[model samples]
Target: MKNSIAILLCVSIFFIQCKEADSNSKKPTVYTVGDSTVKNGQGDGAAGLWGWGDFINQFLDTTKVKVKNHALGGTSSRTYIQKGLWKPVLDSLKKGDYVLLQFGHNDDGPINDDFRARGTIKGIGSESEEIDNMLTGKHEVVHTYGWYLSKIIKEAKSKGAIPVVMSPIPRNKWEGKKVPRNNDSYGLWAKQVAAREHVTFIDLNEQMAQKMETLGEDKIYGNLFYKKDHTHTSAKGAVLAASIITQELKKTNNSLKDFVLENPTIILPKKTNIYLIGDSTVANNGIPEAVGWGVELHKYLDTTRVNIINKARGGRSSRTFYNEKLWQAVYDTLQKGDFVLMQFGHNDGGHIDQPKYRGSIQGISDSTMVVTKNDSIKETVHTYGWYMATFINQAKEKGAIPIVFSHIPRNEWKGNSVERADKTYGLWAKQIAQKNNAAFIDLNDSISVAYEKIGAKKIKQFFPKDHTHTNADGASFNASIVVICLKADKSLGLRDLVLSQKEIDRLSQIALNTSIENKK
Candidate 1:
């Protein structure tokens, strides 16, 4: 964690020292021009939608070339030429600079309407349409979509600037899971214009559509585009589109290829991520005998509504998990309204001052202890309750709902009932949760009831290896109980994500093989 912070600080200091020198000697600029899909609503990510032009810079090595977005919302190919949005960009182009052109989103609107008369003629021919522009109240001659694009390419070349033409990105509309392409109309015309002008042309429409279809429609619809919006994209969608453009640009022999960053980052559509963090009791590594409740929990969740990310590993207590920065990884990705379900305590009973070094102190208090390892590195440790409180509080600071789950009950039994943790780890977890005002799921208590029904003799099958872990059938049973508890808690607002009782019962039985597991 300290190393990451130190690297960021060094980068910040370098930028501060070189700010004036960079301003005095600006690098070559790559200017992008188009409509809303290229640069939406002031290019500030308003309404959770942005354009590819706004994110293209993240894929460029800014030390070699800078980027400028000259695209405007609600402008078509003909209107961009008519409204003088392209003039300033053309005037500023230098000998070695590059200007990208991608228009056509709004070119299909009514040409002579009073609302926004921005449409152009249908084809690439020299056809012209004379209209008394209803919006501007002036005589105007509109050209074809191809003609408007050709003018930009030719004019940009006349000023000694390289021009690259691109087809507009595809909309969220789909036909039987296949993205509908614009190859027949605007794409064909844009390609023809670029060929005639002898400039580089990128078919972003077709290319991006292929990627979208492969990524699946479920991951795209609500995540990339706002619900009910076919056009425009969320910030995540913009990043995906920009990544496609950067990939295509570097493939060309153009000078801009030298400016593209090596191994540019590709961002997928953003969704609400629900992370499950804990020990091996919550993880599955293809071990049939050691399946976890977190693995079987996927059977009951509405995957389309939220992403279930299981970050749980084996043999990690709350203290060791935070100390190793495993919790930091999940904390970095938490967005407002996301959820974090944390479970620990499987390994918290290990030795703290010894070589194993996984245990925390006993109770829920702001207490600390210092220990030295065999390598002579000194570390400060806290109580199990303090670590639990830290997890709950940090999650709240990130605006994520933190759910405290007392670790699942083991197979050990005392006489008639399964062994309980109320006197130990379970009590501490509950106290920390109450103090933090967080939701607590007493897996140790609720799961024990089911175990007690089956009795210790019949439950031995779940723990073939030891008394700690459960088999696949037992994991499914525990997961069903967890779902029921989640649905009853209305404060979490996750009732709609749980499966119906009928489905839950079917999955919990694990094909009716675990009849003895949750039998009435």
Candidate 2:
């Protein structure tokens, strides 16, 4: 009786281990498989060319969802399988994952070449070609592009992973004021395969071709593609392709659409420059956990319309910024149509002329105090308001729009209410802004309101080390709030540079949902 009981116990333990291992392999990941158009050389911007896979993560909430790009530079649908590349991809696919397949660029090449026999039989037909591939040195039966696509889809489905078929992004080929589509060829065939397999199909080719034509030849040549290379895309073109894919996915109602960044960055017609000048809270660079809002704010704006240049430095007050020539660098780059966003006071409240010599006089007065530094250099200091006024006047003289922002609130709280800089630096920032007739963004009060709503206990994760700097999540929250505020004030004339109010509202709701999940 004891020997029989031992055998049964061992069997039960083995089953439990198998179940645990199976559950561990079930984490959802998005795998991209294609040619150079999907992922260029080494998946790096080596020669200014990037694949759509390189920039897809920028449009998705990648911190929550993982994206793996397994595309090679010169492989077709036929070679990808014949060369055993697809086997590893199949091994990685499990239940609750997605595999995006995009090819057709190299599929138009020679079939039995001694160099690269990467071509596939055309169309979604059941045609097949038997050839000893020169590249792989193996006997192979190559089928139509649709046949290869179907094989990948069916195999991914067998692993319980969803397969998403994508038509190749259109090359920079134009047929008199309009780009031609691959409607009768790869695009149609890819769509047919997805329909046959009953999976989602994203028409990336049509979407990208239309966008390219709309951009005009001038913008498309130098800005997007590098003129000579029409087959592969530059970094900008790749990002544009990825953005269009996500936008199409939004319409398709795919589950992966949920991971897409709301109002993802895309190239637009008009262009402007947005210069940001502030302190560590605005320019935090290296600390992996801590991120500055300025660095992430561009994700909220359309890159094609305005380029955000974050010139803010860590541990610099407005007084020191001008003194250190950091502000001058941005001022020189300022153009007539550019916008300047200045946020200070986080480091401006430090001791004046002492340990750091970074703080300024309290108010918006023209008060000046002269002091001698340790290097025997005589330095002239001005009021916090005076420095703010100087920056505003300088920006205006250069035909640039200057928008003043009060420093963001720290994590400190008083009985569930977060600390607001409204009485001090916030008040001065607004006073200077109003005095110069500049647009004012009350970042201190705005961030404090959000923090209070989120509550102190829940946001402890935002401040890992101290009360001043914010982690990536916290910076993203602040940037979203800034976008919301930017949309609210039309006098800033940033309507085209930032997102719409409806988009920010949706983003705010997403943040709330994410917070709720994190708490759970």
Best by TM-score: 1
Off by over 4 Å in 1: 1-26, 223-227, 266-520
| For every candidate, C-alpha RMSD to the true structure in Å | 11.0, 20.6
Evaluate residue 63 in candidate 1 and report its C-alpha lDDT on the 0 to 100 scale. 69
Clashing pairs in 1: none
CA shift of 450, model 1, Å: 33
> Mind sharing the TM-score for model 2?
0.51
| Model 2 lDDT at residue 367 | 87
lDDT of 2: 0.84
Where in model 2 is the C-alpha error above 4 Å?
1-270, 505-520
Report every candidate's CA lDDT.
Answer: 0.85, 0.84
